[model samples]
Every structure is written in C-alpha cells, then in structure tokens.
Target chain A: MTVTLAIDCMGGDHGPSVTIPAALHFLRADRKARIILVGRTEAIEPHLGTALAEFGERLRVHRASEVVGMDEPPAQAMRSKKDSSMRVAVDLVKSGDAQAAVSAGNTGALMAISRFVLKTLPGIDRPAICSTLPTLRGQTHVLDLGANVDCSPEHLLQFAIMGAMLVAAVEHNERPSVGLLNIGEEEIKGNETVKQAGELLRKSGLNFYGNVEGNDIYKGTVDVVVCDGFVGNVALKTSEGLAQMLATFLREQFSRNWMTKLAAIFAMSALKGFKHKVDSRRYNGASLLGLRGVVVKSHGSADAFAFEQAIWRAAEAARNRLIERITERMERERSAA
Target chain B: MTVTLAIDCMGGDHGPSVTIPAALHFLRADRKARIILVGRTEAIEPHLGTALAEFGERLRVHRASEVVGMDEPPAQAMRSKKDSSMRVAVDLVKSGDAQAAVSAGNTGALMAISRFVLKTLPGIDRPAICSTLPTLRGQTHVLDLGANVDCSPEHLLQFAIMGAMLVAAVEHNERPSVGLLNIGEEEIKGNETVKQAGELLRKSGLNFYGNVEGNDIYKGTVDVVVCDGFVGNVALKTSEGLAQMLATFLREQFSRNWMTKLAAIFAMSALKGFKHKVDSRRYNGASLLGLRGVVVKSHGSADAFAFEQAIWRAAEAARNRLIERITERMERERSAA
Candidate 1:
C-alpha cells in the first residue's frame, strides 16, 4: 500500500533541523511512502537539500506561515495559529492529500487541532492519546494519556475499543487483549466509573482481559490497557519521572570514585546495550486514536532518528488502514446495538 | 516521652519469622521505645527466644488467637477476625496501651481495622496513606496512596493538611510545601475536583506550591504531593512496574555473554551502590494519617530489616506526636472557618 504522511516540519524543540532530516530518513527507509513537508518554505527548504532531487515527486513542501509554541494553551493555539505547521499537517490529512499526519508539537495543542480538523469517528465520543511503553514481555499500548481529564464510563469503553483496533492495525494482532487499568485485578476494585466500565467491556465483544493493575502495563499482561485520561496521563508521566531518576542515579554511581569510574569503562558495552533496550527514543510515537484520520504525536524533545520513528509509525498506521478498521468496528457495534 | 508500638506478629507473608525479628531489632535501636508483639503465643514465642530476656520489660508479647490471611477481604477480616493479631495490634493503640501500631499485613485490612478501632480525628472525614519516596533533592511525602479512591475537593484538602503534618512530624520540617498532583501545572488544567482542590489548597494556609505533574513527585518540587488515592496508587504502582522492567533489562544485558559477564564483575560495586540508593525497602513504611492513633503499614513482603524500618517510622511518628499535630491543625482550621 502507498502511504502519504504530512509532516509538521516546524514543530518540536529542534524544528526544521530535526523534522526535515527525519522526513528524509523516513522517505529513504520506506519505499512506498510519500511526505508533504508543512512549514515555512525558507526554513524547511534549507534542510531538504538534495533529497528533493533524488526522490522527485515522492517528497514536497506545503508552506505554512505560523508555528505553535511548545507551551501554548490548546484553545489559544486552535483559535490563533490557523496557519501553523501542525494545523496545516492535519489539514493535509483532512484535505485527502495525505493519509496520515505527524507532529512533535505541544501535545494539548496537537490534540485540539487534530480533533478540530479531523473530528472523531462516528461512534467515538472523544479521541484518546494512545502510546506504547517498553515491557519485559515486549510492549503494551495504553490510551487516554492526557486528552480528556474527566471521562464517562462510555468514554472508557470507547477508548478500549479504539485502543484494541490500533493494536490490531499496527501490531497485526487480530484479537489483542484489552485490560481495564485499575488498582487491583479483582472485580470489586476501583471507583464507580471503572467498575461500570469493566461491566461494559466484559460485554463489548472484544478480547477482554478483565481488570489489570499499573504493573501489568510493563509486565505486558495485556496488549491494550484502557483508562481515563487523568489516570493514564499520571501513570505515563510517573514512569517518565522514575526512569529519569533511576538513570541519573546509575550515572552518579558509575562516576562516584576511581574504582567505579573504571568499572563504568569496562561495563560500557553492556551499559550501552542495556540503554538501547530501554531507550525512550524507540517508543517515540503516540497514536491519537479515535480520530477520523491517523495522527501520531512525537516527543517534543525527540532527535532526528526518534522523529523518523514517529513518521514510520504514522506510515504503518496509514498503510494498515487503522482509521477504516476503527470505523468499521464502530459501525458494526452500532448496527448490533 | 516513652513511645510504645504494637506490632502485628502474625501478619505478612513470613509472619513471626519476619515481624518478631523486626520488633526485636526496633526495641534494641530505640532506647525510649517499647513494643507489644500481638499474635498467637505459640507462633510468636519461638522468634522471641532471648530478645525478651535481653530487653526486659521493654519488649513483651500480647497473645491473639486468630490470624488475618494475606488475601482476606477487608470487610470480612474486620467483621469476623475480631481476635486476629492485626486487630489486636490496633486495639492496643486504641486502648492507649501503645502510642502507635505497625503491621506488615493486608493494606485494606489494616486500614479498615485501624479506622474502625481508633476512628478518624475530628474534622477529618477519612484517613490517608502517606509514604516517603526517594527524590532528587531528598524525599517527598505523597498521599493518599491507596486509601480513598474517590476523593472530593474537601477530602483532598484534608489530605494536604494531613500529609503536611506527617512531614512536619517525621521530617521535622515545620513548614513543608504541598503540591496538588495534576496532569498539568497550569491553573486551568485537570478535572473539576483537582481544580477545586487547588483553590482550596491555596487558601489552606499551608505552604501550597500550586499544581505539579507526575514527574514533580521525583523532582522534589515540593515536600508533599497530595492527590486522590486512585491517581496516587496508579502512579506508585506504575513506577514500580517501570523500575522492575528496567532492572530486568539491565540484568539481561549484563549476562548476555562472557565479555558482558566480565563487565558485570567490574561494575558490581557501582551497581550495588546504585541499588542501595533506590532500594524500595529503605522507603518501606507508609503512615496512615488522620487517625486518632498513629498507624504505619509495612510492605507485606518485607524482610527483617525492611519491616524494622516500618517500626522505626511508627516510633518516630509517635515520638513526634503526628496524630496530635494533625488534630491541632484540623482544630485550627475548623475554628478559623
């Protein structure tokens, strides 16, 4: 399948310097893919150099005059930054010029813009931010990272269906198990919303794994873990905080004294291997599930290699017809109901 | 002032094998402290051996005929296991025989029994689970870890006051800064409850630090972080899961080959130092705040040393009059209103 992705070339910390290079790398890696670079012509062109010549019609730029600040408020950005690169990227998907959109901009702004432009699927109440985390058994996809803070039980059930569909499309697992993220695995645990959501999921005709705890996400106990945005966001950020603290601790220990420093030298190769396995860069892309079109959000601080992975994820999702799958599944549910 | 702690000897996975030894170690360490070991006499006697003789009247055992199972339901344990060791431990604290209670038991059972026996302090609706976590600056006290899953703005405000008092007592910090845990630091972020809680905390007269994200917990941005128990518990367990995954990845990396094995040998000391710094056992005790009597919950899987740390925490809180401090704070708030 031929996949076309609109790249938000002016988003993220490094802007065109990182995004343009990543778009070029992604174009090279995926032979059946095309990219529309959306940003200021002057800024994005400088980084594209000879890639345009080599790829010909496969790569091009779509000029956008404005850029959204990393910390800009979502509503303000949505109202004012109409010509922003992030907006134009999502617009390209809406305009049917691209099958998917990718951005490494302000998460709240990206979600706001994407939801505004692309809208939600027919049966989806809200779009959820879904992302993968490294697990001992592989990886698990968790949804509602920080989109909707206060979600109803129906929203959680929708999130579960959307997450499961995304995993099925991206990971090619037809019957990916869905787990309701709760404090305990028992049925009696959690608040009223979660308890009601659990009941909804058990009858949702999906491969439900009942309720799972926070540790189950890393244990890879289920393929897709569904939660309200508030809890999911806290869990994701808490993991980020802890991983950073442990890394800092390890670095301090290795550099403490002469003997430890020498030990770090000898352990360099193993440490590098260990670092590669747990690198957050590998898990850069976060899928904005439940949207009408594929929209993947990259980490704000991602480097070129990491940003390319985001593009790759968007491409994979588009190629696998993620939106169509979710649409069809929702349609089936509605028809059955 | 002499502080007496009631230890639940037949609780936890190892029962008296872990709790009795921990109690003896605690008795030896605290010259001004006494312990009442509550459990079946037959099971508790063998572990006491020479410790009771050595410590004289400072250590003594109070026999309880029944034991609460680790996986027993909280309500069942409270209703049926009236004479369980865990119940006897809280009973001693309730009767003023001991100033505090320490238990390595089912958290729900401990909390239920403690609340049932001693009751909540005046003006406090529910007790909170407050625990210290290792942070970059030093340590941060966070609540409510797993006590009240669904908390209102008022309940969260109570938690802030209770957590701040716990810090003031144990850490000897008269004015500890408190942060409301939210998805974002902006004033307009989070659910209605959190936004309302932020407003209440701002006017709470405590050292409120506005809103903080999950990462702020480990950054030591504030001395105390207060959140609804559901969010706090998920964050805590998510951290545990990520840490476990990273550790497993590191072990696998170091044992991959002969060359890596050599590197592991060289890096052993540095690794040990790093491990010791982030050891969960060092931060074992969780204070059950807002109760009339001090009660600390140890990890159910704690060893002798870790369980002793829980006892030490109970002793410190009792010595520092944690309950009285909270009670006085609540009284002042109520009077001010």
Candidate 2:
C-alpha cells in the first residue's frame, strides 16, 4: 500500500530549517512515500522552495493558522491552538489522507492532541510513549517513557503486549522478550506494583522475562522493557545526561595538551567509529504506541538527519500495519481471557 | 569528637576479603577513627592477622553467630539472622558504641534492620537513600534512591528537607539548593505528585530550585535532586549501565588496530585521568538519610577502596552530626508551621 506522512513542520527548536530539509531528505530516500508538510505557508515556502519545484506534487503543504510553542502546557494549548500545525498533522492521520504523523513539537501537547484526535486503540486504556535506543548487542525498546506516570500493574502488562506486538510487527520478531523494570530480579523483589505486574506478565501470552533493573536496559537482555511512565522518563533522561557528560569529557580530554591532542588526531578514525555506534541521533524516533494511527516523535533539538530518521520510523510502522497487529493481539488476549 | 564506625565484615560479595581490608585502610588513613568489625571470628581473624599486630587496639572485632545471604529477603533475614553481621553492626550504632554503621550486604535487609533498630529521626516518616555522585560541575547528592517507591508530595518534601540538611551539614553550605527531579523543567509539568511537591518546595524554607530533568543530575545544576525511590533507582542504575557501555566501547575502539593502540598508549595518562574523574568507586557511599543514626550503603561488588570511601562518608556524616542537624531543621520547620 502507498504510504503518506503528516509533518508538523512549524514545531521543534529550529522549526522549518530542520523539518523542511528532513522532509526533502526523506522524500529523496523513499520513492513511494509522500509527505504533507503542515505549517504556516510563509515559513514553509522559503525552506521548501527549490525542493518543492523539483518534487512537484509528491511534496505538498497543508497550511495551519497557529503554532504550538514548545513551552505551552497541553490542556491550554489544546483549547487555544486548536488550528495549530501539530493538531492539523494529527488530523491528517485521523482522516484517510495520511497513514502516520511525525512531530517535534511539545511532547505533552503532541500526546494529548494525538490521544484526543486519533484516540486509543481497542482494548488499550492509555497510549504510551515507546522509544528505541542503541545497545551493545543491537537495539532495545523501552516503553511508557513519560505518558502515564501512575500506571497500574494491568497497565504495565498491557504495555508489554503492545510493545511486543510493535516489535514483532516492525522487526519481524516472532515473540520479542519483554522485561519488567524493577529494583531487583527476584520474584518478590520490587515494590508491590512491580511484583504484581511480574505475576501477570508470567501468565501473559507474550514472551515475558522476569524482573530487570536500570542496568539491564543497556545490557540488552531483553527486546522490550516495561515500566511506569515516571521511572521510564527518569531512566531515559538520566541516560541522556550521562551520555552528554561522557562526550563532554572526551572532547575536553582530547584538547587537554599537545601530547593528548596529537594522540587524538592519530586515534581519530577509531573514535569516529565509536561515536557512530553511540550517537543518539541514529535512534531518534519515539513511537506513541496504543494509538489507533502511527505517530512518531522526533526530539525537539534533533538535526535534519535525526528528524529524517523519525520520518523513516513512522513510514516503516505504517507499512508494517503496526496498528492492526496491536489491535489483533489485544483482541486475541481478551478472547483468551 | 572522635568518630567510630561499625562494619559488617561478613557482608558483600567477597565478605571479609573486601570489608576487612577496607576497615584496615580506613584505620590507617584516619588515626582518630576506630572500627567495630562484626562478623564470625574465624572469617575476620585470617584477614586481620598482621594488621592487628601493627594497629593494636585501633581495630577490634565483635563476633556475630550468623550471616545474611545476599539473596535473602529482608523480612526473612531479619527474623532468622538477628545476630548476623549486618544486624549487629547496626546494633553497635543503636547501643552508642559506634557513631555510624557501614554495610555492603543486601540493601533491603540493611535498610529493614536499620529502620527497625536505629529508627527514623524526629519529623521524618521514612529513611531516604541519599548519595553523592560525580557531576560535570562537581558532586551532587540524589536521594530516595530505591527506598520508598510510592512517595507522596509530603514524602518528597521530607526528602527535600532531609537532603538539604545532609548537604548543609557535611558540605557546610549555608543554604544548599534542592531540585525536584521531574520529566520536564516547567512548573506545570510532571505527574500529580511531582507537581504538588513542586508547590510545596516553592513555599518551604529551603533553597528550592524549580524542576530539573535527568541530565541535571550530571550537570550539577543543584546540590540535591529530590525524586521518589522508584524513579531515583532507575535513574541511578541506568546511568551505571550507560557508563559501562561507554567504557566498553572506548576499550573496543582503542584495541581496534595497532595504529589505534599506539595512539591509546600516547593518550594513556589523559584517559586515566578521565577514568579517575568519572570513577564510580570514588563516590561509593549512599547515605540512608532520616535515620536517628548514620548508615552508609556501599555497592555490593565494591572493592577495598570503594568500601573505604563508604566508611569515610559515614565518619564524615557522624563527625558533622548529620542526624542532629536534620533533627534541628525538622524541629525548626515544624515550629514555624
């Protein structure tokens, strides 16, 4: 089936400078894919001028009146910026025009607007944010990144099923293993909620590994890690902070003295390879799972390549029928129960 | 006043192999400090043989009948291993024979036994696990690191108060700044508990910085970050995992080829310095704050140097009268309210 993506081009730190270039790059890469760039007409026109001339009908713009500020709260923005670029992008997905939507706007606003418009899939109580990051082995997906702060044990189990279904559909894994993030690995270890979730997961149809800790996320012991939004958000942000610190140290070390500077020059290629492996930009998209339509969030400060990666993620998820697969899994689990 | 520390010599992965040497190193470093090494006499004797001859009465052993297994649950271990090394070390603190207690045993058991015996200080409901971590600016103390999973706004405020007091006492800061760890930096962001905690912190007498994300931990934007134990634990562990991953990648890169190896040799000293800066062992101790007596939790797999750091932390807290300072602050806040 032909695929289409709606882009909230007026979102993120750089706005049109980043999103328009990213859209052009994605269009160049995927022949069958088309994108509806949603933003103010004046802002979109300048960035997409020559590219739009070349791509013709394949790249088009859907004008929206307002833009959601990065700092605005979700509920207020929802009431005021009803015709915002982020809202229009989600609306395209809600209608039959686009298969998936991509945004680099305010995360809370995006989640709220998407949930309001697209709505949660059948048998799912809430839409969770799932993101994939690089691991030593390959890549691992962690979910409920910041969507639902106070998740019940049942919510965690549902996150597992949804995460597994997404991985199974997107990566073609038959049964992706899911790990319940907790303080300790034993059956009786974590707090009451985690312990109860473990019991529910053991009986769930998905491949459920026992309890995992913060360290296990990077260890790549499982394909998916399930946790409440609060823990997942902290873990994700902490990793981001540590990675930034290490990178800063590396840069400082290389510039310390002439001897180290000279050594850094010689070791440039090796360091380059290592940097590529751990680069956060390489894995930029965070899927808003459990939504009826495919939606991927690009980091607010992501560069062109990173934003393009978000587009690719959204396109792939749509092509693989991720929503249908998740729906089927939910229905199967419910019927069995 | 001289400070004395009680050590659970039979705890940790290596038992006396780690604890006995740590105690000896600590004794050698601080002449005014003394240790009560509690464990099986046989297990303690072999490691302390020649050191006792040189150090004489400075180092002494307090024998215990049983040992707590690393895998044993806290409640089970508490009932069965009443005379265990960990319990007796805490008992030394309770009996006023030692100013503080240090352990590398099962964290849950140590916390349970400490709470049951030493008890919480006045105006504090629960003990929070607080620790100093190396940051880009310097070191920051983060609290409630896996101690209380379901923290209310009131609990977070208490943690903020306890963390501020500890930092003020040990670091001698007049009014140390505290941050409420949140998913976002905005006032309106975060879940209900965090939002409520923010409001409380704003009104509280402490130096309250608004909200900070995970990266702020390493960025050292504030002296202390207050989060629930669940989020704090995940953030701590996730950082550990990422640090491990980065180190592994660096090693792999440096060994890739002879040219890279040659470059690594030249940059060895710079790399070593960087390693020393981010070294987890240097920041090994986690203070169980809000307790009537000082308790420091060392990493389970810590070596002598790491364990010694834990002892140093405990001694410093004891000397500074952390508990008394916390009590005074609590009393002040309560009276004002």
Candidate 2 scores an fnat of: 0.78
| Model 2 Cα shift for residue B84 (angstroms) | 2.0
lDDT of 2 by residue, B26-78 (tens): 89889999888999999999998698787777778899989999988899999
Q: A1-337, model 1: which lDDT tens digit per residue? A: 7889999999999999999889998888788899999999999888978998989999989999999999998899999989999999999999999999999999989999999999999999999999999899999999999998999989999998899899999899999999999999999999999999999898887899999999999999999999999999999988888888889999999999999999999999999999999889999999999999999999999999999989989998998989999999888777766
Number of the top TM-score candidate: 1
The CA lDDT at A67 in model 2 is 97
Per-model lDDT? 0.93, 0.91
Q: List each candidate's DockQ score.
A: 0.87, 0.74
Q: Which stretches of candidate 1 lie over 4 Å from their true place?
A: none
Model 2 C-alpha lDDT per residue in residues A1-337, reported as the tens digit of each score: 5699999999999999999999999899898999999999999998876887888878889999999999888998788888999999999999979999999999999999999999999989999999997777889999989999888898998899889988987899979999999987778767888999998899888888889999999889899999999789889988888888888888888889898898788888778988998988989999999999999999999999999999999999999989999999889888877
Per-model TM-score of chain B = 0.99, 0.98
Native-to-model Cα distance after best TM-score fit, residue B116 in candidate 2, in Å: 2.1
